[model samples]
Target: MGQIERLADLVVRAGVNVQPGQGVVVDSDTAHLEIARAVVEAAYRAGAGWVEVIFTDGPIQRSAVDHATVEELSASRPWALARIAEWRAAGVASIGLVGDPDPHLFDGADPARVAARRHDEVRARRDAMFAGMRWSLVAAPNPGWAKQIFGEPDVDRLWAAVSTAMRLDSADPVAEWQARTATLAARAKQLDALELTAVHYLGEGTDLAVGLPPNARWTGGGLIDHDGIPYLPNLPTEEVFTSPDRRRADGTIRVTRPMVIAGQLITGLRVTFKGGRITEVWADEGGDVIRAQIDADEGARFLGEVSLVDRDSRIAKAGIVFHNTLYDENAGCHVAWGQSFPWSVEGGLAMTPEQRVDLGLNQSGVHTDVVIGGDGITVTGTGPRGTVDIIRDDEWVL
Candidate 1:
């Protein structure tokens, strides 16, 4: 089978693990219809009860972001929200196929307005679905994205890189992923046994500390939903992650890879935290956009998650900066702002939002990750037993 078809099969059968008689939802941009169609076909072949495709248009979205009134921009279509709710209520599986066809679509737009206009209601609905449904995010390469990365529209090259990152090249991709997930699960168990009180990051331009709650637990790879269906949230995931105590982070850290945020490429991004709230931000480019996003809401300034990945990650080994968080964040250690996952701590989902905030779990409409691991980076975990090296020279030590 061709790579696209193979990827469709992987996403349907392994990524979201669409079971027989289950409904499936595929969300994609118009530019990605090829892969979206493949996913629909694969889902049906797997005996899916139904498959729905929601196609988005990038240029139209850009126009809306640039010209729409604040109220209009913030408003979400009731039907869209209702559709997701219905799917979630029915225990459906979802696949999000994302690849920005125009990475710089809003480069000259007003960053503050763009930040102010985020669809809060839509985000809440999506978060609710995330907490209950089986879902996966997969990439769909397009000429525009390829041109942004390589200075030329080489879709074939982009496809090859994406396929490799997704492990589509493996003789048995499903089995390979299963083995990889088992290994990551073992690593997560080791970190959990440490009972770490805090993690300290040391490297050039980075000397930061992130505290962990007593109930924090590390997890990676596949996750089992309420119905016992296992799913991979990201096609090329590598990091084992946990929510940090949002009230306890401090010090400064530098981003090692460029981040494409809201159609702007942010480079040389540096941030300082005091009492878990972002106090300062600097970047060689797109600092205004970063500031605007951090100021979006009350909890947007706090740390929501801290994830660790070593140099040996598949994405890191590939040595390509995809400029997509779903891929780049997996290449190294990364930290997120806003919206912590409830599954990161024991009984987290059951806790009320206020109760979770009391435990230092951050809450907000934004969840953005910035990669921060590379050569010379060292991560140490501190607990009752003293400090233990968790990562050294960009490699996982224990």
Candidate 2:
């Protein structure tokens, strides 16, 4: 098989681990038809009972934001909500393709309006997966994504970069991923032993303290689905993470990597948190876009996740900015605002909304990751053992 075909097999066997006779869903953009089709075929080969393909159109999505009335944009689509219930009931496995083909599709649109509509759409899918459905999100190489990264539509070069980050060039990529994930998992256990109450990040223009829940447990490598099937939620995964104590994040943090939200690029972003709430949000570009998102709900201002990546991480050492959060966030230490993962804190998966709120677990429907650590950024943990170095200058020392 060719490299792309090999990637398809990995997405099935490793990404989500499609089981025999399982129903699979392939959610993709029209621009990623080639890889999507390959994935569909791979699922069938893996003995998937059926494969359902859903295609999203970027231009159509942009047009809706451009002309739709505020009231219409604000209303949740019943059809979308109904589909989530169906997927959850059927126990379907979903593989959503990432990698925006047209990063500037919503460039001229109103940032607030764009964020609102995108949040509404994402809520349905996120709800489905969080509810019970098994899912994975992987990226595909296309001309538009290639052009955005290399400025020349050189898809081959972009693939090479992605492959290097994914360790796809290995003779047995699946085995390589398995080995890497195991190593990372061992690191997570060591971190959990620290019994950290919080982590402090210090760097130029960055001094932020992110609190962890009382029983927070670090998890990474992969996650267990509702039915006990394990899957890596994000392809090319590298970071081990835990949900934050949403009520305790404070200080200022300067984002080191560029991020895109609702098709807009955010760079040189700096945010300040006071009383666990975002008091300031600024960026050299796309500041309005991020601000609009942070204002989506009360929980959006607080942090949900904090992740650590060492300098030796494949994605970090690749020395190329994929501009895709799936890849960029794995390049260094990062934090996510909104929607705490239930798995991060003990007994969280069984907690109700009120209980979650009381425990300081963020309940926002949004989960936006922002990379904040790179060169000069040092992360130290405050735990039962007192303060200990976790990451020093992008190196995972613990």
Candidate 3:
């Protein structure tokens, strides 16, 4: 098999663990037809009963967002999410490919409308999966994504890096990944044992404190299918994570790196969170929109995820800051707001939305990841008892 085919097969079999007679769903753009086809073949090879593909085009969606009506924006599409939810509820498998064909397709569009038009149907699927199901999200590294990272638009180079990052070259990548996951899981367990009260940040123009919930548990790596089939969320991932105390985030967090959010590039973004609400936002570009979204959604103002990626990570070593989540999130320590994964909390999957809200667990349909760690950033942890240094200069500290 060729590199792309081999990688796709591995992702379906090892990363997602598609089961025989189970439904398989793939989400990709037309530009990724080849890879998407490979994924379909791989799912069938794994004995999937059926494979469904969703082709999403960036330009078309951008056109709709830029010109669609208010009714269209708020209109819910239950059918889309229903398919995935039913599949998962029936113990189906899912694999997704995220490779933006037009990184800046909606760069000039109204950010408010762009954010508002998202389908709530998809949110149900996300909720169901987080409630306990099987899924995996990988990237195709298409030319458009490459162009977003490298001005020359080097698709081949990006693919090569992605292949290496995903470990497609290894003779037994599944085994290799298992070993890596065990190692990282050990680190997460160690951190969890520490029972940290807070994560403190100190760096260039950045000083923030992110608190930890008493029930917070350190987590990393992949999840399992409904039938207990295991899978990885991001290929080449090397980070340990946990859900932060959503209501306890305080202080200022300066954006040390640029990020592409909702089809727009946001630079020099600095946000101040007081009592878990975004009180201020400052950015050289695309700041107002970021502020609007956080203000629009209920949990968008609270913290959802706290992650730590070491300098030795594959993405970090590659020296590429891919604007996409598949690569950017693996590049370094980052945090997410809006939606909190139910798997991150104990007995979370069984909790109702209202119960989750009472426990400070957010359930917004949106989940936007933004980088906040880099060179010279020190993260310290402090509770009522004492203080423990967690990260120094962007590296994990024990």
The local distance difference test score of each candidate is 0.87, 0.86, 0.77
lDDT of 1 by residue, 1-398 (tens): 99999989999988999898999989899999899999999999999999999898978877888787766776677776777678768888889998888888778888875666546565755575557788889988999889877889899999888888888899988888888888889988998888898999888889999999877888977798887778898887888999999999999999998878877789999999999999999999999999999887898999999989999888998888887889899898889988888878888878878888888888888889998888888999998889999999999989
lDDT of 3 by residue, 195-258 (tens): 7777877878777778776666677766665557678877767888877778988888777667
Per-prediction TM-score to the true structure, in the order listed: 0.97, 0.97, 0.94
| lDDT score for residue 43 of model 3 | 87
List runs of model 1 lying over 4 Å from the truth: 116-118
Per-candidate Cα RMSD to the true structure, in Å, reads 1.4, 1.4, 1.9
Give the better candidate number (1 or 3) by TM-score: 1
Clashes of each: 0, 0, 0
List where candidate 2 sits over 4 angstroms from the true fold: 118-121
- Candidate 2 TM-score to native: 0.97
Backbone clashes (count) for model 3: 0
> Global lDDT for candidate 3?
0.77
Give the Å shift of residue 129 in candidate 2: 2.3
